[model samples]
Structure formats: structure tokens, C-alpha cells
Target: MNSVVRETPARRELPLPDGAISYLEWGAGEPGKAPLHFAHANGFNGFTYRRILSGLSDQFHVRAWDARGHGETTLTADPARHRNWYVYRDDLIAMAEDFKQATGKKIILAGHSMGGTASVMAAAARPDLVRGIALFDPVMIPTAARIVMLMSQLLRRRGNPLADGAEKRRAVFADRQTMVDRYEGRGAFRTWPRGFLEDYVEGGTKPREDGQIELSCAPAWEAANFRAQGHNITTAARNLHVPFALVRAERGSTCRPPFPMLLKRRDPAAHVMQVPGSTHFLPMEFPDVVAKEMRGFAARLEREGR
Candidate 1:
């Protein structure tokens, strides 16, 4: 059993193969109704969905797990697990098994970025454990995404990519209001709340003896993970015998090849929708929209007896 007690509405923990896995579990409703299992993206943790989870907790059980390197999970002492991509997937697999054993039901796999890719991989490997899948801007097009991943990896041995300045790379604010303000000002941080960065920083860092915080998941590990992004989603997605849906942000990068459009166009079974006025971080950028779409998708699957 998971030796975890809820610290906040957004964070939870579970004992996995290696150690305790920190996660963000949401939604209330009744028990045994097929919960939505969420997964976070890179440079962010599960609590990034704080506001989003609060609104959806009433209708469905929304659960998000911190990947091997983020949130309360760590890899500083024994870097072996975070060093490999398969370790993250293996941790997720354990989470699925734990949830299934506890609830006696499969879940609706929902993921973002790398988490989205991991969701696909998990569903592909354990179809019986997944009734449906919903992915948000998962790093697709194994080639390009892999390049990005490799670039991140290359930066690991060299130095922190964002070392030049924290103000440049990704986030715009250290505080919530500051983030919201800069979102419109800088144009990159829009739609995301302050909690996203807070949770990300909290989950991604560990205390150092010299009072410095070191990244829990090494940049190299993250790079290696990204480099392996091009593992062929088409083949994996095609073999998906379950219902699947995709929610893409209007301004985000593509996770798959452009041909997926025509391919999905021909395969009418796969449903895809665009979340307008949103960025790559659908859950963070637009939680209400994400919840509304996810609820509808899950409701349809439930009706179909999935």
C-alpha cells in the first residue's frame, strides 16, 4: 500500500518499485467510477494542475503522478532510475497496477508532453489496464522530438541550458501574479498560473549541503529521455484497440508528423480537437477547457461501456 498522506489537495504519494512516487490526485465523485489518471510534462510537476483539479474533482477522479524526476520524487542519491527512460515508464506501470489493484477498474489515461507519450506507451503495453487515452501535445514525430530530447541531453553534459538566466528559457514569474502579468507581457507564460512554477520548482529540486538546490532529475537524464522520443507513435497508436482522443493547443509544437493529420483524417475513429486561446500546456494554460473536454470524452467512453 502507498505510505502516503495528502499534503495538499494537489499532491499525493504512492510506493512504487523503487521508492515513494509523489503525485497529484484530484476529483471526488463516488468510488469505482473509472478515474482519469493524469501525467505531467517536463520541467513541471503534478501540482501544476492545482486550479484545474479543484474544478474537476467533483465529477471524476482525476489523478496525476510525478514522473521519476519531478515533484517529491528524487534521483540525487541513486541516479540510476532517472538516468533511463524505461525507469519512468516502469514507475508509471507500477502506478497503474497499484490503482487497478486498489480500485478494480481500468483508468482513462490522460497525459501532457512527455507524460502523454508515456501514457501511450503504457496503454500500448497494458491495453487491458487502459480503457481510453487522452493526450495533450505529446512530444510526437519521434524524429524531431527526439532531436529536441537529444539537444536537451547534449546540454546536460555541457551545462544548464537556462544557466545564462532564469528569466529567459521557460517560466516568466517566480510568483503567481507576476507570472500572470508576464504571461501577457512576455507572451510565453500566458494561461498558466503561478502554482505551476512553484510546484515545478518544488518537485524538481533537492537541498544541497551548501544551501544550493540541485536538479533532482539530471539534465542528461531529461535529454536521454527526449532523444528517445521518436519511438514510433504511429505504430504504437495504431495498435491501440481502445478509444483514443487528442487535444492540441493552437500555438504549441507538433508531437507527431504532419502526415498524422491526413492519417487521422482517414481514420475517423481517432478524435482530435484544438483548444483555441491556449498554449502547449493545456492543463495549466486552460484547466476549465481541459476539464470540459476531458469530461465529455470520459462520459462518451463510459456510455460506450469502456
Candidate 2:
């Protein structure tokens, strides 16, 4: 059984070039203290990771936000405009800048999977705004895999295959509990705790006027994110100069050893931990472990006076 205590985070929004991004805050966020800004994985929202984010609030002020198409944030009406994940990277950069300006200290950027990849990209592009980064099984495809994935995109002319799955996904349910009941112990959510799954269902969906709940992030957008995985993560990893900690799942990690090895070579100070018997959804399955490492990364940054 999971023993982590969860808390409700304050919801807020930040206006961006295209639309406003919704974020959740944990802790007081005292001024002059460096804040931890988090991004959620693809198809998931900031609220989905509340258990993990809330666990670290005692030591640090943390905030997590929904990407363009996830959670309460505005969706991208035109997927054509965001062919790559650079748009997500830019949004992260903007959020970091805004946090720096608001807190008068560089923010610690962190994320999982697609969110983690975007954090690495933002940190590399604008190192001044970020003091450090912690990635949780970031969507980092190896060079050979990347080439194959990109080449496979050419074979799908009937729109993105992943997107098709999203489009066919069930969006509404009888209620939140019903959704939770159906999702628990089923498919990808099998490893997720009941409380965490409930939180995800509560935050990821909204009640419609028709007396049903619907996903805030439309299927097409989630599919677009999967299809737009051609970003150059290798270059970003090479360019990252900030202190970074990467925790990968042992069994089904999106980030393999070579990528973490490359990151260690590029930044010797970087920390890497592979949790045995875990999957890519380590953040959800092991919130306490992930939060401990995040705090440790912060401690390391403070030790280095970064």
C-alpha cells in the first residue's frame, strides 16, 4: 500500500503567446527561495502527479503545470503549428522566466517523459533561467530508434496512428468514481494507486452540461504529442550545463542506459538512478522515491551554490 500523504494544490494560470497555461502550486512559495517548476507527461496533467509533488512540499516550494493540450490549459486548435515539441519547450522556458521574475531566483525545472524532454530542451536553450533540472524517465529515444521512429512516420498517411488511438479513446463516463473503477487494475493504470488514479480522473476530466465528464485534453492533441517526437534530445542533453538528476525505470524506461551515460559524460556532476523493477511510469508508481531524489537534487544544487 502507498503511504504518501497527498495535499490539494492551488490552481492558477499563466498567459502564453498562444493561450494561458494552467498550473498547480504546493507550499507557500516564499519569495527569494528558488522554486521547483514541474511539467507533466504526455496525455497527463499537472494534477495527475499531485501525490509526488505534494510529498516534497515540506522541503521546497513546488509547482506543476499542464502543457498546451493537457489539463485545464488551452488546447492547440491547429496541430500543424506545433510540428515539433519545441513549442512545449518554449512554453516551459516562458514559465521558468516568469517564475524567475516572480520569485527573484532561478527555478528548478523538472518533468516526466515528454515533460522531462521539454525541461531538458528549455534548460539547454536558456540556462540562465534554470538552476537545475530533474528528469523522470524522459522520452529520450536512442539515435537508431529515433531514426526508425521518424522513418516510420512516413508510412502512416492516414494520420498519426497514435492519434487514431486517442481519437477512439473513451472521453466520458458515468462519473469520476465510475472512471476510476474502470481504470483501476486495468491496462496502463494497473500500477497506479487508487488515490492517485482518483486524483487523475478528478483533474483530467471536467463535468459537462450534459451530465457527463469529458477529457480536457482532446484526443487529437495527445496523439499529436506522440507523433511529434522527432525532437533532437541528444543535442539538448549535450548542451545542458546545469546540475541534473535523471531517474529511469529499470524495466520499461523510455530513457535507456546509453542516454544517461551520455548525459553523465556531458555533465559529470549529473546524477542517475535506475529503480529496479519499475516501469516508465515511475513517478506515479513511486512518488516517494521520485520526490526524495528531487529533493536530493536540490540539496546538491545548494551545496554547489548554483
Top of the candidates by TM-score? 2
TM-score of 1: 0.75
Lowest lDDT block of 10, candidate 1: 163-172
lDDT at 23, model 1: 72
In order, what lDDT does every prediction score?
0.64, 0.83
The local lDDT score (0 to 100) that residue 12 gets in candidate 1 is: 66
TM-score for every candidate vs. truth?
A: 0.75, 0.93
List residue ranges in candidate 1 displaced over 4 A: 1-11, 27-29, 75-84, 142-191, 202-220, 258-267
Model 2: how far is 260 from its true place, Å?
A: 0.8
Candidate 2 stretches with Cα past 4 Å from truth are: 1-7, 29-32, 75-77, 157-164
Error of 2 at 127 (Å): 0.2
lDDT tens digits, residue span 1-306, model 1: 111223346466787545788776654436755677888876566766655655666666767776875667743323333333455556777888877776778878888887887787778778888878887887666546445655765677443333223323343234443433444424434454555545555555566666555655555445445444436566566565667778887885556566347336534676688777767866767666676777788888878777
